[model samples]
Target: MSTTTDTAPTAVAAPPVPPRGGVTIDEWHPEDEAFWESVGRPVARRNLIWSIFSEHLGFSVWLLWSVSAAMLPRIGFDFTVSQLFVLVAIPNLVGSLIRLPYTFAVPRFGGRNWTVISASLLLVPTLLFAWAVQTPGTPYWAFCLIAATAGLGGGNFASSMANINFFYPLRKKGTALGLNAAGGNIGVAFIQFFLPIIVGGAGVFGLVQAKDELNLERAGYLYAGLAIVGAFAAWLFMNNLSGAKSSPREQLAVVRYHHTWVMSFLYIGTFGSFIGYSAAMPLLIKINFWNQPVPEVPGIGINFAYYAFLGALVGSIARPFGGWLADKYGGARVTFWTFVAMIVGTLAVIVTLRQLTPVPPSEVPADPSTFVYSEATRAAVEANSTIFPWFLAAFLFVFAATGIGNGSTYRMIPLILQRQAEHTTTPETRRADMARATKESSAVIGIAGAVGAIGGFLIPLTFGSPWVTDPVEAVKMAFGVFAGFYVVCLATTWFFYTRRVTVAGRAPALATADV
Candidate 1:
């Protein structure tokens, strides 16, 4: 959790830290050991707790469509698989776009103020979701618009991450960022785990039957209550640091750095995959295993509900540990290995899909009684029985690898910036050097965050609308593309961060001198 930037300050003592009035703090210095022990830790911890709660709720609302869309068919909606994919995918698209503006909001408005604003915005999607499902004859375009509202939650991650980045010292960035992200990531799992029971169990615990046989609207109403609580908690507990304030130019300047784009590309592979797969998994199970018979149970069977939550759950839980590993081994090294696993995991899924085959007919029936054994029939049977386990295992590995990569890549960001600053700056004082490096790293986080989110949208769209007509084939091809993309990311990470190059007649990797 420590950085190479550890250095003692100049002989002169720092000014007395000012007391906070309301949510704003006029003075802050986390790198100042005495100041941090007395003031920084307490305020940062308070803010972190509320930030995680709000961001967690945001994530749940953003991905709520994943469950709602899957239940549409049984609840009397007649949308095709392609249409449903679009419905679920729209939030990721909108969320990705919203992140750029949301990243700046923390500095423009104070962190505490922006968090309240962002948390309150979740109500739009939750309310729209309730109304949309209750009304019949809702057009595809209308659903698209409603889903887009959910993107507000996605933006919370950017703002939350940016805000928390200012709270911790360089030494603890990995753990803090990982915890924040893992908290948000768990929202996907929570929604997936509970939404089914709420929608299918009639009421909570099936105490009373929900209005419809499959009460999809209940999912919307459920999250609406939680969003309000989250907003209230954020307003009550969080504080803004004066140190976190910055101009738009200062924040956006990270775009000019080559390293920002490199990290962004790597992040897309890790985070984009985590989210995309989590959102798409339920529908994938339903679509591919459409003919699989549900076993006799109190609730709906074989709807993919049985397994959908595990991917997000495992991915979320693994994230912090990934960050811890990065802290010990270096981010670039951990990330490179993560991409290797992602490539293998994705290819395994593709192999399972391509290998699918039907049980052959003993003989063709005679005359009018002849039984037809078509390729379509074979594909369905194979999908339900033989290929299901392999597909599931392959995807779960993809989730795990992405989760680890998520942590490792994030840890790299600040370390990379710290290195760059140290190499360029000739400051005689330690505090000045630390200040400059912190500012640059915070800027790059926002830029990289926005770019990485695009992967969430791109992945679903790729699988949803492949060049080929067959949905199964489309999925196979999409996995192949993902595998290829990982290879590119792997190479990119090594060349830029891990691979050593001679500089000024000495051999050391870029940023290693002060990472």
Candidate 2:
């Protein structure tokens, strides 16, 4: 009895508290197994779901111009082909420029708060689009400015990615981030697929009847309503983590790492190609395939709207697969192979392009209002029609490769930064170094995203090629250039990550590091 009275009491763990709505979490510990199982999982999942929704809508708005530009001629805008291409490229350019600021915005304003604000800002672009389309005699310059506002949607990608990076532990981040990105990337396909039906341009697989004329403003209004819903959803359902604080200077420190710049360049090949092709595919189909006479089929041509969404859909679906493969085989290996595939796909596209003949300027009507196909133009169209399927197949292959590359390259970023951190840390400082690595990786994601998006702008401009007399010739040249670029990307991936390398008598290759 005297020995029993001297025994110490057992300690019990406290019950987990349920996550509160619209509040900052003061103490977050995703890496702690007990904490993650009891509380972190549900909270992180809720944030990820809403983040994906808002970002998905943002992508829809950003790419509204891509589909809209193809329809403008139908409504009597009478703009040149180059001018229409400019409309599509403007949003991409603006979107790329704003991504850096958008990335920093997550830490400054808090994820939940910034998401609401960013979602609300989408109203500016949607409403402007509605006004521009409905208003008679809108100037080209005015349309350019209106299109620039759509870039607001592009910025949402960087911020959403950066914010979600803070919510997951390293083991699960790849899958979580892949789903988030895939959701947003699919927005391009969603708008391209649905806007035609929504605006009464074409029926869904001929299920619905198309309007005699397009009501383009209807698309703007529908997306505007969704943006409002996205904002409200974030305000009601999302939470912010208090521990996810960092100054711009702290985040910007990632720029000092050589890997950051290298990753950004590689990203230009993957994400850049994905987005650039998404923006241009509709128009590319329109210019090359639509209005062309099919062989043995009188008075019938390909409908660009019917097939334009496929490229984006295939790419979006392949993105998650890319991430999975990277997880199993390593990112550098996946990325190098993806670049090789892209190069092959691009060359195949050029081969398809070479088999067709385009209508000369003399055969094309100066005013679309008075357009009619000449016999020679009809023959050219008929010849081109036979090769359209081949062209589409080649482009789709490239899209799939880009999607895979996008996922692999993103997965590589976190592993690379973590390895770098391990190289410099002692056992006593391991925890602190890991935490810093997470922050740096998140920052690098934003930087690479911003840089990669510039390709979206450049690709469309290259295709448009206002200075060139022959648009088809310009396209062929562009494909050749793209193939060459992918080869360079392949070499870069091999040299820096895939091959064994010695740095000051230490093995520093990412391949050897198991990243």
Candidate 3:
């Protein structure tokens, strides 16, 4: 009864691998018929590392405007405050629109192909930014056009997350994703804080007419060179991870679960606030406290972007803590507290704004709070004295809440999915479905991440334009309004998940099957 007892020697297949770093062996098989992984896992992880780095560079380029716009006036570019906001907001607007479709790019094109193409696209805007600043003749149209190309960087986060999700286990996803996301988010702070010092002055990207003013043409070339370095690094080190599946129905079907929608909205609070406020910070410092002595003992005052990055740094630091907190307590519980804190933070800013000049700003007053003639700012007349600490406190609170939200939202996804799996299937089937959900949750996470990042762009534009007495008032009013959205998000969570009568506790059958 022996099947095919022909004694032909069977050659055992060897594992495949990337070119051995120090050891060289040709004809490697990663997915060998016998050992389908050993070789493959190492290669997959290497690719993931590179992919995250390249995407990180993309984000740095995308939000470069947030830092650079504050420099325009200092660089002798003829831009008004409104014009400055418009310019800063250009990339934000374009980047947000691109994120919706970018999540699907992976399934359509291999992640490898798109990564290469998208990474390459960043060069366009970087080069253009260098060019625009060089020539004063550069009309607003040209600036807007160049900024539009920066959106390419923003879209990379979506596709990259979608691609990476296909490569790992479910339990490890939060760590993996948090790393990838945090890497990208840090870029805003990194560039903002460093650029002023590196550039040697605030507007050094442009001509050096005054200590503060710079020529655009010179700055353009410099920034372009830096972007080129980033592009080259991406191309040389990054690997495209392919052969993954995350169709809209496959990935976004999570939306069918009302909880997914709730999470998405809450993300607008946590993530949206992070993104919006990060971009606005630079402008806020310049408008509000320009008259304050530059903190640099010998150097230029704190650059707008530099000040803004503090908020981001705090936000980044808080993310892991948020995740850890969610792990210990339920996401719903953590999120409820985040709501309370953010509301308090927003109110602080509003109170700060209301207190600015209890007497009219125009009245002949020696009030130290006012930014009047005797103390004209290095840049311009400062908007208010107390605005600084108030804004700072507000930013700190927002970042803390957002960090909590990041952890809570991420924590909720798997629990929700796992709970659903447990309820919907037979014991045997439930185990299998739960395993499947563990994997699918990764994809859902990737899609949600990309979707959540769009808030970065949206939050800026939303609060960027509103209540624009100046950038300072604009931010305060905007955050106050933004806080209301967070409140609504809190109510939604309460209405759905935390509610005793919710499908979660009430009709357990529907919770598992539907979500």
Candidate 4:
């Protein structure tokens, strides 16, 4: 009965006017433990909604450069293709590396406080971007610095997932976390989709442009605006749900689990696919599809690319759905199939690119690309392009499957840890303590999460191929390699618990659903 659209923000519980005895006052209230357990579902659900919304905004702002980087020439920035990719890659790189530290921040400081800190940091990069863009004389170093600031937004994902993990029962952590993550990821697609509209429809920087200055100020200001709104929302409605602290030593202790490493690799497969394809969407479209371009300022390239939005959109929407599917079936069941599907999707792309790409020394886009047609290509043949559908399908399957894996893996982790913990404990104590599983599960969550989030950066870099002769052949080889990697991962799942464990979340197997 409850859906995001069905939940009314105004109907949610109101934060108290004044602070009460160290209570976290935000969108959520963890003031009463009993109340949180009994009446907290609606409240947490509402919080999840807002949390996703704010986190979503964070992703959008973080990815602003990825969208804008595509339009750099229109903005008067003379960036090379490689340089542009690197610029887009910067946020992902820093964000990936910082995930561990960000995961830890919640335990050190309250989640409420960290949310504000992380959310507020977004302004620095965004405004810096705006500032750098305004100064026509600004150097490349300045742009790079501003772009790097966007990395701040990327850290929000790890912390957000970490905080939310403290809020749920192990049984529901998958769905709850899935909702949170999917909601946040929607930001990536949204920004990519809307930035073009904003620029194309309203002359994107229209609000910030002065006759004498470059109008790119809106790019940063737009991010600043989203950051401001998220901060205000956090201050208004977010709650600090604390507990689940293991000392730094305790957290480092979770790294000992082999499960952590296995899942990390799987993450590089699923979430990596989501992040990699998302970043690659526009370039895929621009190089492959016909677009209408407009002349902006003489020195800059400013036209919007229309076809790229679909890839990110499909990827974003599929994530939560995948999580739901995993809940119904098993994480490994869905994940294995999903991984298999990703390979298929990539193959489709490889085929499409080879077919669409122009031949060497042929009339194609002015610059060389990853795919070039071997035979003379016709406009009618180009009209029938497979790149769009294949790329879109690849992302859709990847995002959804990643989400499913997220849930199932989340479910499996606590269960796996519980079984392992019980093996070390005496029967009477294990029977007496039902809560042990919940506690241990919570402890390992941040570790797995921090590891998994790295996929966001790794997948993109994985897809970032070396320069190639036949753009088409090179891309084929690259995707073929990626697809092959997925196959190995699927094998790992089968070898591990999934093969013999016969768990409930596994195919037809029923293990206790503690996770």
Candidate 5:
């Protein structure tokens, strides 16, 4: 808790909260130990909890189509693997674009008010998804349009992060933000994990079907109900803080900072990779690891959809640890190494892809009466079995690296802003300078988040359709391209932040004082 003395009256009872509608706290001094201990802590915690709930629902809604797309075959949708990739990829494209406007909405409408509205907005996509999926003959254009609406969930992350930034003291902000983000990130994993079970095969608890069946529309209905809960909870419990308010000019000031753009470019490698890889993994597994049953204890021929959640689960869980590491080490140093790990991990995947032998073309009848099987054809299935575990491990490493990079890159932003503040401001104006720096950092974080999410759309497109003529070769090519991008990120981090440069007469750090 903060230890500063407060001139305001010591609360004789609990602090007063707004009585009607959503609560609004007009006075917030989280930096003042007395105010924080007395009034800020509880209010902040309450807002954070509801924010997590709302954001969590948003992520699940945003990625809902990914799981559903994998089930399209069973549903008789009749889309090619390429068409399905486009179906899943459309949401990511829409979601990335939605984040920018969503970021601005927090300040324009008040965080609590916007959270209620944004959470409620998720209903559109969910309902459309359900309605579209219920009819197998739903036109591809209609499905694409419906999928785009899911991007509403993606927008929630930016606004939610920007809002929470205002609720905590500087010392606690990193940890609080890390927890909030991790809570949302895990929702992707949870959707993937529960989707197969919810759509049900073997009727684990008799809540669903007993035989293998695809109830694709169930995914949409599940999240739509959760969206309602999120909106209601935000309306009933969350608070809007007056201190967190910002004008367009102040928020836009971040655009003038050169580091903002640089960090955004790097973020494309971390967050972009994380979200992109996540959206693509279900399809990748289904297409590449085709012959293996997902190891059901009581059943045979279980689909691989059950295990698709593991990549996202590990990635989301690793994110907080990444932030913590960045806090201990310098964010620049941690981020640089994260890029290194990502490069190595992706290369491993490419190598694994290379090990698989391609299926040969069918030979024409030798004597016009009989055909012969090529050796390559006979060995194709055996090669898949050989490469599955190795491929899984390589991709898991990629996921882990992206998760860590997401945390580290974000942790770096605030410190870089603080360094800039220290360099430009006088000692007498230091407090005000730091506040401005924090505000600008918040803006840049939103922008970087939106920019980074573009990776999600690009990755699936890069890999071509899941049914590409040679999926193994396509994956190899895609990983090679991704690895090259990481190398660029590593060099950028080292050059801008980790290396010391002389300003005036002395060497000053870009990430100064354990930053």
Candidate 6:
């Protein structure tokens, strides 16, 4: 019997496999410390890097009109100040409207699939821009239609944020999201800084000579090429997580939460302000501080293209720092203080605006190359130049506050939903509830992003209101309204999350949740 005995082989466990490109990951456990250390971190980092690159290009395409609108006159497009402002505002309006659907597309399709689709969509706007600028007979309505296509780029932020949200644990969400957002936000600065040089309007810090004539179509061609590269990168490097799947009805259910709407309102004060101010900054500077072909001097006034990029640069850099502060202190705490700073900055800007005399619409020449400035117009330009430093400093301070608020407000969303889930779950069901909460948080982020973007449309339109006879007065009125809105935002933040309040025996206070 011993000689004839047969032996059976023992089973051996296999090592975990790393995530592969363009593949669907069926298992993901980012919240697990051991799993995160070994696999989740690397996978998350890889997706985030490509997400940022795609989103950065998206943002640049979205704001192509921001820089382009200011240069239209030099390129022989005769449009009024109000009309130029409309060109910039149209993209924001379309972008905001498309964001809700863009958000849901991530979970419906897959993060990787949607990213490739979105990145490819950017070519539509860039190509349209190229065609519109190059065609001599393009009508104003046709230009508006082309600008509306740029909104395709704006929707990218919503989907990218929602996608990245699913890849990180609660502890790292603040930093991860902030870095991703800052990377995209910096695109505003990138286009503002480089487009003028590309279009032959200005040089690199005035050190390099610009082309003899403006060529706005060059900007379109360059960004179009970059958009193709972004699509290829996403297709090659990104992956879809099976765990992120959700139905549109389930995602839309997040809107029922009171906190969702509250966050949307607060985001309007932060992100809305950032995008809106970015679009309006160049035109504001052009109208207030500089006049092309100054009276006797051919080119002797403050060039807006030279300094317009600085505000976005400072704001983009500050966003990550704000997220770090929120992680250490608390998101609500950081957001509240940011609003206080915004109010003060807006008031400072108003003071600077009041110091300079407004340039009458009648005085602004339709043909800059063939016009001369009157005594009054020349003095107004001189006064504007003197007050320019104070104005720029104030606006920069405001942009910094908006950037900080943007980071902190977003950090608060995931924490708030997580707390809600904890209060509603028992020990047996905690994991399932927590997973649902993550999905809700992502949905809420998309909603807030969409609502906040509406502010971008409102801002430039307010500055160049067709109904308002005086653009300067309209701008001053707009700042006053903005300051009032920030006061409401400050109070709302305190009332909801910062203050100690009980909610139907769910939890002691939201503040205790570290939101």
Cα distance off (Å), candidate 2, residue 459: 0.3
Clashing pairs in 1: 202-210
TM-score on alpha carbons, each prediction: 0.87, 0.93, 0.76, 0.79, 0.87, 0.93
Error of 6 at 295 (Å): 12
Question: Which residue ranges in model 2 land beyond 4 Å of their true spot?
Answer: 1-15, 203-209, 292-300, 360-372, 502-506, 509-513
Error of 2 at 144 (Å): 0.7
Provide backbone clash counts, one per model: 1, 0, 17, 25, 1, 0
> How much lDDT does candidate 3 score?
0.62
The clash tally of candidate 1 reads 1
lDDT of 3 by residue, 1-515 (tens): 77776688989976544532222222333324333256545655665776676677777777778777877655556666666666666676677567656766666655665666677777788778877777778887887788778877777776776656555454444555556666766766676666665555543323322243444344345445655555555455544443354456665666576655656677767776776677777776666555332221222233354356787778766765666666666667777778778888778767766655322233334543442433233233334544556767766777877776776677667667777777677966864576556545555555566556667766656555744655556665676677687778778667655655665446322222112
Instruction: Give the candidates in order of lDDT, highest first.
Output: 6, 2, 1, 5, 4, 3
Candidate 2 residue lDDT tens string, 1-515: 35545667888978697596699988787889888998989999999999999999999999999999988877768688889889999999999999999999888889999999999999999999999998779999999999999999999999999989888887777777888899999999999999999899774655766677789999899999999999999999998877777899999999999999999999999999999989998888877766632211223356777888888888888888888788788888899999999999999999999998866443435553455567776687788888999999999999999989888888889889999998899999998898888888989999999999999999999999988867677788888889999999998888788877655665554554246
For model 6, how does the per-residue alpha-carbon lDDT over 34-134 read when each residue is reduced to its tens digit? 88988898889999999999999988988999988988876778888999999999999999989999999999999999999999999899989999999
* Candidate 1: regions farther than 4 A off: 1-22, 201-212, 292-301, 358-383, 428-433, 502-515
Residues 49-71, model 5: lDDT tens digits: 99999999999988997778877
Please report, as a residue range, the 10-residue window in candidate 3 with the lowest summed lDDT.
Answer: 291-300
Q: Please identify which of the two predictions, 1 or 5, would achieve the higher lDDT against the true structure.
A: 1
Instruction: Compare candidates 2 and 5 on lDDT and give the better one.
Output: 2
Model 5: weakest 10-residue lDDT segment is: 292-301
